[model samples]
Target: MPTNGSQAGSKKEFQYRTQFPPDFDDEGESSGYVGFEHIVGTLIWASSQASLNLFEASNTVEAVTLERHFTVNSAPDNWQPPVDIWAQISFSWPVENSTLSLYGDEALCDLYHSETTHCRHQPLTANIVTELEIVYMFSERLVSHLDSDEGIEKTAR
Candidate 1:
């Protein structure tokens, strides 16, 4: 990872790892494990990391917008034929205004392209915005704690 000295103030590194069960075989040389658990776990873990990164990046700049594009090149050996997993997520945060917004206009094609679908354009209430800010703050703290060396040592013990 590269560092932006002026924006970041200091360089900080974070690492994440995924552990698979001993019985599980990822390669096809042996009987490959047939389950969605690992895939789901990886997605969840990546989402957490993305959230943390977004939070940190947003703090340095006025606003940060992120779009994650996922493509599935191949499916598990046990999966049935014709499996397609392609999705995109767009999230934005304006820290100065304490606003966090998610735009999924292109996430689901059917709903997004349908003409009959009526999307509301009402601005969120003050209370709702406050709640979102609180959630963001909490997530930042939780991610920081979980990424700390002390937290890792505690979990290991």
Candidate 2:
């Protein structure tokens, strides 16, 4: 719930919230990264907020959109479990070109592993990355809107 200074030269503060896939801490098959269903649920909530124009009021958008522009199918050979169920869930604001994708599988596990001989040194795991990505996207959108007076124009839409 922290606020950021106006990068757009406006007095209004830009506020944003950090979000995680539901059941992010649950063990076993119920973990947040276990499958796409849980991730979709989170996106659904975000979409609902947009439909209600909640974001226009507070600049507190969570997940942005469930874009279906790309699709990947599972292959029998060189395949990983849960990768078959994977879907692209983008964490980019409507105005930003940068995107962070979340995938639930071995690559993610390795990306999240502690620095070791066999693992890549990625200190920020998927969850942390997702949270930070949302914050960054929110800030980017805020800057864009405030700088060009787009916030007012967008709200009027």
Candidate 3:
């Protein structure tokens, strides 16, 4: 189950790796390049933020659902475990086709100039290249209630 903060059984783990295309450098030696590190770091940071936001939104929706099910006079004696949500998200950007002008080559400069004269770099266009999987679990009683025709009718109402 996914957890909040440093609680036990937290499913919060992050892994990141970067690869530069062979054409990123003229001689195919990316070791001497110094600018890409920042780009990769920024991508990682942004992806982390996006993951956190997704988690937060899921939690918020779960909380709202629980609260909506409670009423003034018939509150349950105990609350069930919150719905579990987990994500394995990945972000990828093709460096070779990047329009950021990270390189100072004349071809890139000419392309940038021909594309736009704003001098501001293009926005990083990253693809979320993984499926967002969310899992939900409830107590047996809650599941039974949820599966009942009355529950379905109530939800329809």
TM-score of each: 0.16, 0.21, 0.21
Q: 1-157, model 1: which lDDT tens digit per residue?
A: 1111112222222121235333334433111222233333454455454442111122122223432222223223443543332122223223312221111112122223453444352221112111111121224555666678773435443
Displacement of residue 143 (Cα, Å) in model 3 is 12
lDDT of 2 by residue, 1-157 (tens): 1112112222221122135344543424311232333344455555455442112111223355532221222222333443322223233222111122232222344334432334342333333222212221234554565679543645443
Residue pairs with clashing backbones, model 3: none
All models: lDDT? 0.29, 0.31, 0.32
Ordering by TM-score? 3, 2, 1
User: Which parts of model 2 have CA positions greater than 4 angstroms off?
Assistant: 1-40, 46-105, 108-117, 120-157
Worst 10 residues of 2 by lDDT: 1-10
Query: What value of lDDT does candidate 1 attain over all alpha carbons?
Result: 0.29
User: What lDDT score goes with residue 128 in model 1?
Assistant: 13
lDDT at position 62, candidate 1: 28
